[model samples]
Target: MKPDKSRSGCPDPSTNALQWGIKVKSSNFLVIESDASRAQAIVSALSFLGYRPVLADRVDADETGEQWRGAFVGTVEDEAQLEQFLASLGRNARNLPMLVAADSPVATSLIADDARSQLIELIDLPLRYERLAEAMRSLQTRVEPIAASRRFVGQSGPMQRVNALIRQVAPFDSSVLVLGESGSGKELVARTIHDCSPRRDKPFVAINCGAIPAELLESELFGHEKGAFTGAISTRKGRFEMAEGGTLFLDEIGDMSLPMQVKLLRVLQERVFERVGGNRAQRCDVRIIAATHRNLEEFIERGSFREDLFYRLSVFPLEMPSLRQRLEDLPALIGEFNQRLVQRGLSRVRFAPSAMNALRQHGWPGNVRELSNLVERMAILMPHGEVRGMDLPEKYRGALPIEEVTGAALIAMMEEQPMIADSFAYGEGDPSVLPLEGLDLKDHLAGIEIGLIRQALNSANGVVAHAAKLLRVQRTTLVEKLRKYGLSETVQAG
Candidate 1:
C-alpha cells in the first residue's frame, strides 16, 4: 500500500503548478484508494500541488456534487463498486477527467469498455505525480470552450440559419419540433439544443416512437409498475422519469399511434402522467424536443395525427436542410469522414475533382446518412488510394455522348490551320461544322480522347475493364491508351 521509493523521483508539485501558471487554492480532487498509506501519499502530492484532496473509499454522486474538479481511482478491484460509483455521478460527470491506477487485466478491460471512462487519463499502476500533473493540465485545456456552434459541421447558408435558430431557442424550455429527412441529424440537433440549454447538467434521454410497438409504446413513455402487464416483472421508470429535469427527445413522433399521441398530449398539457397500474401521478419537469421525417400536417389531414398535438409540439419549429440543399458542405463533411476513418485504422482517401463534381450533382434522397454510407463504402473499397471519377457508382455518372473522330481526320484539320478551340462549341446547336481560321487537330483530338476516357472511366467508377467496355475497346487497348495519355494514374482496376 506504501509508495515504492525505488521508483519515485518525488518532484516538487508546486514547481509543476507554477510552470502551468495554475492558481490552484481550493480546487478539489477526489482520491479513491482503499489503501490508507497510498491514499495519504496521493493526498500529500495533491496538497503540495496547491489542490485540496478529498480522500474517500468510494465515489458518492450526491456528496461530491460539482465541488470536485477531477478524480483519481486507485486499483479498482470491484466492478460493481466502480459501476455504482460512476452511475451516481450521472450524465453530467461522464466527461469528468479521471486517472485510474490498475495492474490487473480485469480492471483495465473493465475501465476500457465502460462508457464512464471516456476521459480516462491513464491506467498505469503505482501512480506517479508527474503523470498526474500531465492529466490535470490536459483536462484543464478541455474545460475551455471554443464555441457551441463548432460542435456541428457545415457553414452553408441553410446550416448557418439553423445554427442561429438553435442559439436563439436553446436558452428557453419551450417545446421544439425538429423537421428533417431520415438521416438528416435530427437527434444531433436535439442534443445540441439540450447541451446549450440550462438543463445540460441533467440527463438527456431519447426514444424512437416509431421503433417501439404500439402495445408497448405507452409503457415505454410512462413507467410501468410491477405486474402492470404480463411481462412487467418490476417497477420500471420510463424515458420521462429518466429525463427528469433535462430533455426528452421523441424521435419519429409522427409514428406514434392515436392512443399514444393522446396520452402524450395530456402529458404536455397537464405536465403530469401516471405509471401503468399506478394511481400516483408524476410531474413532468423535462423539456420536450420531438423530431420526425413525416409531415405531421399531412398526417393531420389524413386524420392520423392530432391537430392539437401538432400545435403543442410546434411551438418552436426547426427545419433541417437536406444534403442536396447544402452541397457546399460536402468537402468539409468528406474531410471529417476521412479523419474519422483514419481514427478507425482505415486509410484516409480523397476524391478526384470529377468525382467530387459527380457527388455534388447527386440527388441525396437519404440525406447525410446516404452520403456517410457512400463515404464508408469508398473507404473500404479503396482503402489506400484516391477516389477518381471512375470510382463513383454507375448511377451517379451522367450520360456522355460517344464522339466518333478519327486521329487522321483530327491531324488533317489541325494541319490545315491552328484551331481556336475556345471559339467553337462542340456538339451544340449546329450539326454542320463551322468555318474556322485556325485548328490544332492533334491537341483537339487528344483533349477529346482524354475527355471521353475520363467520362467512360467515371461511368465505370475506376474499373478499367468496365471503362474499356464502355469505350467499346479491348482492356489492353484501353490500358495502352491510358498509359499513352498519362491517364492510367486516374484509374483503378477492379
Candidate 2:
C-alpha cells in the first residue's frame, strides 16, 4: 500500500503504522488503546493484514460519509478512561461490536448495566493473530443487532408481538404498563422502551415498590426534606426527580398500598408532586413505566388498587409471555445468557441434546429469570464444558430415563410399569392377535406408547401436567417417555 498523503500531498509517516485523522471505512477498525506498545502491535497486525488502522480522534464517520465496521478498545487504565473512550465514539457508534484487549475485570466494568446488548469480545494479554482474526470475523458477521433484538432476545410469536408493541409505544410519551409473572422480564421490556425512545440519553431509574417498606415507599418516590423523618438526615431527590427528562420505572406497582396508590395517582393526574414535609409542589417531567406481576384489575375489585391509577399506568398494557408460553425460545434465551456469562469472565457451556430436551419438559414457573439462573449455575458447575442430561439439577432431570439417571436421581424418579395398562392394537377375538409370524412384543408396545403420548400431549395444549392427567400417569413418567420417543415441545406445539 502507498503512503497516505496529507491534504498538502506530503507523505505522512505518522499514518504508516497507526492511522490518525483519516476517515474510517467499513474495512477499518477504530483503535482506542491506552497502552502504546500494545496499540502499535495491534495496529501493525491490522495494517499487515490489509486493514486500515483508524484512530479514535478522527472526525465522526458520519461527517466524512464513512461507515464503521467495529472498534478495538485497548487495556483500560481505569473505569474513567473506559467511560471516556466509549463516550468519545459518539452515539452513532453504539452498535459497533468492540474487541477489547483487556482482562476480564475490565470487560465486566465496561458491560455493567448496559441495556442495549452491545456485542463485545475479550482478548487476553500477549494477543495472538488467530484470536484477533476470530474476533474480527465475528464482528464482521454481526455488524447489525442479533436476530432482530438489541435488548430482548427471542423469535417466537409472543416475543415478536412484544417487540412490536415496544416499538409502537416507544416513540410516544404514553405510560406503559408491563404485566407478567415475576421474573418474566418485565423490567427488560420497560428498559427497552426507554432505550428506544427520545429520552434514551437521559436517566432510567427503577425501584421495586414491593421490596421497599410501605412507610418508606412514599419517601422513596418523592424526595423528603432534611427533617422529614427520623432517618431523613438530609434532603434527597426521589426517583421521579432523578428521572427527570427521562423514564422512571416503577416495578411491582400493584404491590403499592392503597394510600401510596392514592398519592401516586394524584401525581399521575396532576403531573406534579412535592417532597415529603415540603409545602412547595414540584413539576414532574419524567415519563412513567410501571410493571407488576399481580393483576391490578383484581386488586382494584378488592379495593387494594385504585381504578384511576390503573388507567393512568395501563395506557399501553404489554403482557410479557412466560417462558412456558414460548418454550420454543429456550435455545435463543440460553444463547443470550451464555453471551452475558462470557462477558462476566465465565466460560461458556452448551447443553447436550438430551439435556436441552429435559429443559423443555420443565414447567418454568419462574420464567426467564429462572432460566438465566440455571444457565449461570450450569456454567459455573461445568465451566467450558457441555452439560449432559445427568448434569442438570434433580428437578430438571427428574424425568430422565433410568438409563440416563444416576443412583441418586432414582430418589426423584419412580419406575413402575403397572401405573398404566399397555394395551395393544390387536382385537381380542382376531386370529391376527396370535400371529403365526409373531411380531416383536417390545416394538409393538412402544408404538402404542408413542401414539398414546402424542394424543395426550395434543389434548393438553403441550402442558405436561395436563397431559399426565389425561394419560393417568405420573408427570415424570410422561416426560421420560417424551424423551424416549423424541416428542419435544415442537411436536407437542404442533
Candidate 3:
C-alpha cells in the first residue's frame, strides 16, 4: 500500500521514526507541532533517537509538567497560538527549554524575539541527528536537576507548603535550617534544595556534627594541614572545602558542642576559616543547609547551643511534617517504596483499603523512614500480593492517637467479651466473608460492639446498668466503653 502524503507532498510522517535506529542518550520531549502530519514527523524524529516525544494533542488531555523534559515547536503556528501554548504550561514549567524546527527564515521570523532567548535553538528542520542530539544534551542538563526533586514526593498540603518554601529560597544563596523529628527526611529536604538550586551541578557534601568527636569536627569542617594531628599524615579537605561552590549540609547541628558552635558562628560571619594548625585562612563560598531533630531554642536557653549560630543557620526554616500528620500521602509513599523494591529484584506488594486504614491509624513516630521500612518488609513477606488488614504486622494493624491497640489486643478483647461476640452483627450475612477491599479488624470489631451497645441501651430504656445486664457485661465495663467512644454523656449508672 502507498503511504499517506501531506498537501506539501511529504511522505507519511508516521513511518519516518524507523528511518533512524533508536539510541539511549536522548530525552523525553514534547512535540509541540499543531499540524497532524507535522506532529507525527516530530514524534518519528524523537523516537528514532531514543527520545520519548509527546504530541501536542496529548498536552490538551493531560497538562502535567513533570512528564515533559522540553518541547519541539513548529514556527508555522501563529504568534497568538504559540503564546497561548506557552501560557498553558503555567509558572512551574515556565523555564522549560524549547526548540523550534523551522523550514525557512519566514517561519523563524514568526516567533517572538523575547521567546527566542527561551529556546535552545531555532535549527533548520529535516531533523538531522547530530544537531538534534546536541540540542537534547543541552535540554537534559537542565531537566536532570529538575527531575531530582521529583523524588521528594508528596501532594499533601503540608508537603505543598514545604515545596513552596524550597522554590522560594533555592535560587538565592541563603542558609536553611530544617527542623523535624528524627527520621523525618531532613537530609532529603536539604538535598532537594541543592538539586533545585543554581549550584545543582556542583557537589552536595553532607556531614553529621553529632556523629564526629568534638576534637575532630573542627578539622572535618575546616580541613587540616599535613601532620596537624597524629592521624593527619597528609593534608585533607573538609566538607566546606569539598563543597566549595555548592551546598554543605550540616546534619544534627544542635548537637555541636558550645566551643564548636562558636567556631562555626565565626565562619558564618566571616565566610573564612583556617585549616587546623595552619594560620592561612581559606575562603568559604558554599551555602549552608543545616538540620536537627533537637530544638535549638531550648539548647540556647540551656546555654548548650550558641544563640548567634541558631540565627545564622535559620535564614529560611523548613519543618518536615511527620508521616502520621500527612496520612493522605501514605499510599503514594508506599507505592514509591514498592517500586524501589521492584528495582531491587523483589516483586511488588499492594495494600488493601482496609489494610491502608490500619496503616494510617499508626502514630508513625519514626515518620517516613519507618513507613519505607514497613513497605520493604511487606514486599519481602508477601511478594506480588495484596495485603489485607490481618496480613499486616501486629504493630501496624491498629493504633489511634487517643488509644493504642493491636490485632492481638483486638482478638483478646473479642475473646473476653464472649456475650458481646455472640450478639455481634445479629447474624448479618456471612461473618467470614471479606469485602473487596478487606476489613480493618479493630474498626470492624469496634463498629459491631458499638452497634450492640446502642441496641442494648435502647432496649433497656437508656439505663447503663440495665443495658449492661442485657449485654451480659459488668456495668463499669459498659460505662467505660461508652465514655471511650464518646457515645453518650448522660445516662444513669443504675
Best by lDDT: 2
For each candidate in turn, the TM-score is 0.62, 0.57, 0.56
lDDT at 86 for candidate 3? Answer: 49
Q: Which segments of model 1 are wrong by more than 4 Å?
A: 1-57, 60-150, 399-494
Better structure of 1 and 2 per lDDT: 2
Whole-model lDDT per candidate: 0.72, 0.73, 0.72
Candidate 1 Cα deviation (angstroms), residue 56: 11
Q: Supply the global lDDT for candidate 2.
A: 0.73
Question: lDDT tens string, model 1, 379-436?
Answer: 9999878876556776664431112223344335434643333223132233234346
Model 1, total clashes? 10
Name the candidate that leads on TM-score. 1
Per-residue lDDT of candidate 3, residues 265-308 (tens digit): 99999999999979998888999999999989998899998888
**Worst window of 10 by summed lDDT in candidate 1:** 399-408
Compared with the true structure, model 1 gives a TM-score of 0.62
